[model samples]
Target: MIPVKILTSEEAERLGLKKPTKKSGFGIKGVGCVVQGKHGGEGKLMEEIILRENGDLELVFMDPEREKELKSRRQFTGYLKQFTKIPEGLK
Candidate 1:
């Protein structure tokens, strides 16, 4: 019932989060924080689980921390003016 944001690499570093040896080769290792949640309950958590050759794996939430950084990458936004003309067939 709550909305949660992703984690950033910097926030994970300051929290003393380190790579887990036992879970190595499984995926990325780290935890993250969430901003807020529903009814003031526990917020969402973020963490890395595995890492692959192509850098694709599962990231899970283990614990939620407050005031942590958001996601690492920003969303892509195309230029509005450049999109003025639509394809003839599509319309």
Candidate 2:
């Protein structure tokens, strides 16, 4: 599965998802079924996601198109000094 960038509230609205509502009770918003758009999607499907209380969004990857179109920032997590000698002047 390819990584997709998380969308902001405003971004989601702009992308066609409904705006957040106070009355919308939530454990996980996008659940149960894969949101599919027929007619106008041009064969593309709408990916589902969960909106967390802290505004964290989780995308459920059911379709494979995301792998071809999505791009994520590459992050190096391992400690650099463990792999090489520490450089001087910046310590």
Candidate 3:
């Protein structure tokens, strides 16, 4: 499982994730699942799995700076790696 990093308010601002935004219907919504947790502790370590509207599962991360660094080091092949596909029963 991928490790999770919960960004602090400062980190969120640095990553541009705290910017104000207008509502848009084209935005995709997903169900977030916590893959790990500690008893009686703030959720500092956990992976978030998002089941998107298109029936694709995604591991969520908040490090846009790291993503940009990685992208600059290599070419992004315009392909998304799907961890799980929707079940036939759900279709």
lDDT (tens digit, per residue) of candidate 1 on 1-91? 9797666877766676755445665343442233456785885443323334334443333232321233222211221122223233322
Task: Report per-prediction Cα RMSD to one decimal.
Answer: 21.5, 21.8, 20.1
Better TM-score candidate (2, 3) = 3
Q: What is the lDDT of candidate 3?
A: 0.49
Can you write out model 2's per-residue Cα lDDT over 18-78, one digit (the tens) per residue? 7467635545543322444567655555344455554445444335443233323222222
Between 2 and 3, whose lDDT is larger? 3
- Candidate 3 residues 1-91, lDDT tens each? 9898999998998898885544333244765543333698665423345665555576554234433544586732221244453333222
Ranking by lDDT: 3, 2, 1
Error of 2 at 42 (Å): 6.3
Error of 1 at 31 (Å): 12
Q: What is the lDDT for 15 in model 1?
A: 72
Per-model CA lDDT versus the true structure: 0.38, 0.44, 0.49
- Candidate 2 displacement at residue 12 in angstroms: 42
